[model samples]
Target: MVRARMSPRVRQLALIGLLLAGIGLVVIGIIDPGAPAVADVQPPAQPGTAKLAPHLFEGPDGPETLPLDGAFIANVWLQGCQDCMPSFEAWKRLYEAGEIPKSLPIVNIAYGEVDPAWAERYALHDTLLVDSDGSKLVKPQAITTFTTLVVAADRKIVWRGLPRDPGYLDQLKSALAALPKD
Candidate 1:
């Protein structure tokens, strides 16, 4: 058997190559983290009219309608969607940082039957609208992607897209800032 040892220069080159490869992987992962397992539904086109169906959610107060009289943030998600985690984190951070207004409503719509315990475990504490069968609100919205829509008081979608996108968040901030104070 023959034993071979690489020169110091060769070993350093190999180590540097591995380090570069690792950094590249990290960068790629950060740039496009991709989406969660999305439902097989078609999203409505951009600038489409948006309206919250009457009595869409049954809250503690009773059957409720989404307030269309002010700018609000609506996050649409499905149960067990792994990709929604980033969106959740982004919103949480924004909330903690006070980037999201305390007065502005953060509406979370669960597209399917979600356990109350599941929500508690996930810390989905918001004004939740449960669309357990996708009949009332989900189907009507034609929601597809894991989306966060900034809706104006007039039922116009001012900004619509992923909640985790940095650019989207910036756009959201700008849109919210432009909304007339109630």
Candidate 2:
């Protein structure tokens, strides 16, 4: 039997289509194709709101003091939490944004036993306080997962929550913004 021949134009189009399809698939994969179609993950907290940082958690990061006032953010996080790692990134964004006053600190009260070297994950080892023992600073009711506290210069509590909490950063920023303009 004789075989049919395809035109050069058709072949070129097919090749081009295949190439484009491959590129598209790659892009999707890199962008997390397996991620839910909808926004399943809640966004990070905003800059202004109630904060949760109660006391200090001693760690290798020196002494991370929770923000009490003067336009600052206070985050309480553990060193080895997978979830806190990402939130720590978010904290970087918030700090780099120049919204937090220099005096305002991001205190990570690390509970449980952990290595001091982990403080570098959040770039806070030199600038924050670590309270290994939450017995004194953290209240029985204030305890939570990756808790973050946003306090204004007036010593007001605006935001608080774990990394997964909605609007966690917002409460932080809001509290900072509400500070008494230094």
Candidate 3:
């Protein structure tokens, strides 16, 4: 049996409907592209977890390996990610708000082609570690996205994710409070 052909007006309406739906989706993505999806945070890495190799940066005199001997916040960023810039700004606000503890330092690990000049424009001039090898250090550390990791003194990944989540500041405060005295 032959199928009934739809009228020209009906087809045009359907096409317009599909186009509108696509535009809506684009708008939603622009409004709130959420955190990168990654596996559940693994258990705190053993004290002997492999460490990052030494790497060069704009200011340092030579290749310097990030010392793995203390708790720190690693904010991994990429030059191309649309969300990365805003995320950096958000973290900066948190830092300026004094939410970050005085004892814990925040470091930015530029995992890709992040120019030092461009990063500095975003106020990322301090404690920046350039890793142009595309996450060789972060991947081995089991980090799977552009988020922050709360690392323990022993180089263990104590906690990892967006600190903007509700109650996260409190959690961070508690974690820092619980760090073992050496």
Candidate 4:
């Protein structure tokens, strides 16, 4: 049987193409590592009662177990998470404009190696809570890029969701209004 064999030049070109394709795949993986196979599971799917376990979170004045004796807004985020920054900025603006009640405390819970400068930069120096061990207060899988929880004095989560979610502002306003005045 007579068979046509690939020339040396053709064989070299094929090997080069395969090598280039492999390199391209590696570059793509490095650039965008994509989401995890298992998605994070958020807690208290709907607004419900849940307690904040006493956790030693580093603050401006060093570590302390925050006293949840009153209604407050908990802003949970991961360090170096770019998507979480906008939510923090929006909350800051609302607080500065007096849109958020002066009496309500906004606690910023950071999961990961906390950067001290972040507190000052975000104007959250007084309320920053650093969860250095990430999973102390809440499981790692439960904490997403950003999660906002409006908890009443009784440890009931009145509203919980992403800050960018639709009706977020309206729901937040309603939750604040529903909270008992001190």
Candidate 5:
């Protein structure tokens, strides 16, 4: 066996590199610990295939189990997510522009305790639900700062992804259009 040893300068440089990498990772974690790395993020569930479990959430009126008897859109978001507000704003814009149908409700599902004032802040007249029971049902399936699921009457998730995803607006519009006409 041949003995090998790194030169002192090389060892010092390697140590410095490792320290820098560790600091970078720490910074990333501190800035956004909940965010998953790009490669770790799973693609959104296939439309019309995934099923969302019905769970009790605190709504404006009272506690209610979601997936409310018909097709609707669920916007799942975390409490402290910086990206969530922008997404909510975009949704508001879509609704105000008449791109989103009035009959198709958009439910805001907050992953943790949420203030009722969020509805007023976001200018959302639809239901705002808080995961007050701690079921955390949406957390397992949603790995991003925000997720939008278009659920059908049967509870099947007809569409799932961020509202800003490419072609997402068109997909959402199509899904809403396909809902049984009242």
Candidate 6:
């Protein structure tokens, strides 16, 4: 009796198929299936303001804290992204334009580890916080790479990056305008 062995080409093809399957699984695991469609706008949470959990900013260094009231601009970023630098640049433009409220704070949330000083310099003085809400705990809530949220006092997202990619500064303007003059 002779045993048939897979030819070299056949073996290579089988290996490639396995590799592709592994990659697919990785993609699925990272992306959320139940996320809301990008086309729909995020309604502002109202009646009561809910705090973004310290875990969201919790880190080995310390937990990042954000103001509970007023409009806020949070720049969500992944550490490796070369493009994320623009979000920081945009903040500068808004500050120079006087579009950003002087009193309100700017929160920069990095998806992975980042240089504290660099993030600060890039933020142009805005508060920088690492996203301690790593994949281990954080469930991706259906947002884009450059996703920015204008959180109302009630802790609900009043407006998000849509109808136009307003970048950072423009969003700051919209948030400022929405804030009441006390």
Give one digit per residue, the lDDT tens place, for model 2 in 81-172: 67666676766665567644455655545655555566664555544454455454343324535666655665455555554556765655
> What is the C-alpha lDDT profile of model 1 across 1-182, one tens digit per residue?
99899999999999999999999878867874442224644566465365554555755456666775677877777767778777767766766676665558877777776665665554455776777666665665677546777777776676777767878767877777877676
Which residue segments of model 6 deviate by more than 4 Å? 1-56, 59-61, 96-99, 133-140, 162-171, 180-182
Candidate 6 per-residue C-alpha lDDT over 1-182 given as tens digits, one digit per residue, 9 for 90 to 100: 99999999999999999999999877766785544445543543332243344344644467656656565656666554555556556655655667666665666666657777666554443566665444421234433454565665545555555312456455556666776554
* lDDT ranking from best candidate downward: 5, 4, 1, 3, 2, 6
lDDT by residue for model 5 over 28-139, one digit each (tens)? Answer: 9999786567676556567776777777777768877775678888877766578776777777677677777656677878776776676656545467888753345554
Error of 3 at 69 (Å): 3.2
Candidate 3 local lDDT, 36-104, one digit each (tens) = 334533433543354444444433354556655677766777765665555666666777786777687
Off by over 4 Å in 1: 1-42, 60-62, 116-123, 180-182
In the predicted model 5, the residue pairs found to clash are none
Query: Higher-TM-score candidate among 5 and 6?
Result: 5
The TM-score values for the models, in the order shown, are: 0.63, 0.49, 0.60, 0.67, 0.75, 0.56
Model 4 residue runs over 4 Å out of place are 1-44, 138-141, 180-182
> Could you give the C-alpha RMSD of every candidate to the true structure, in order shown?
11.0, 11.9, 7.2, 6.0, 3.4, 7.8
Report the CA-based lDDT of candidate 4 relative to the real structure. Answer: 0.71
lDDT per model vs. reference: 0.69, 0.57, 0.64, 0.71, 0.72, 0.56
lDDT-best of 3 and 5: 5
lDDT of 6: 0.56
| Model 2 TM-score, all chains together | 0.49
TM-score of 3: 0.60
Off by over 4 Å in 2: 1-71, 82-86, 92-103, 161-167
Worst 10 residues of 4 by lDDT: 35-44
The best-first sequence of candidates by TM-score reads: 5, 4, 1, 3, 6, 2
Model 3 bad stretches (over 4 Å): 1-60, 141-144
Over all chains combined, what TM-score does candidate 5 have? 0.75
The residue pairs found clashing in candidate 6 are 45-156, 49-154
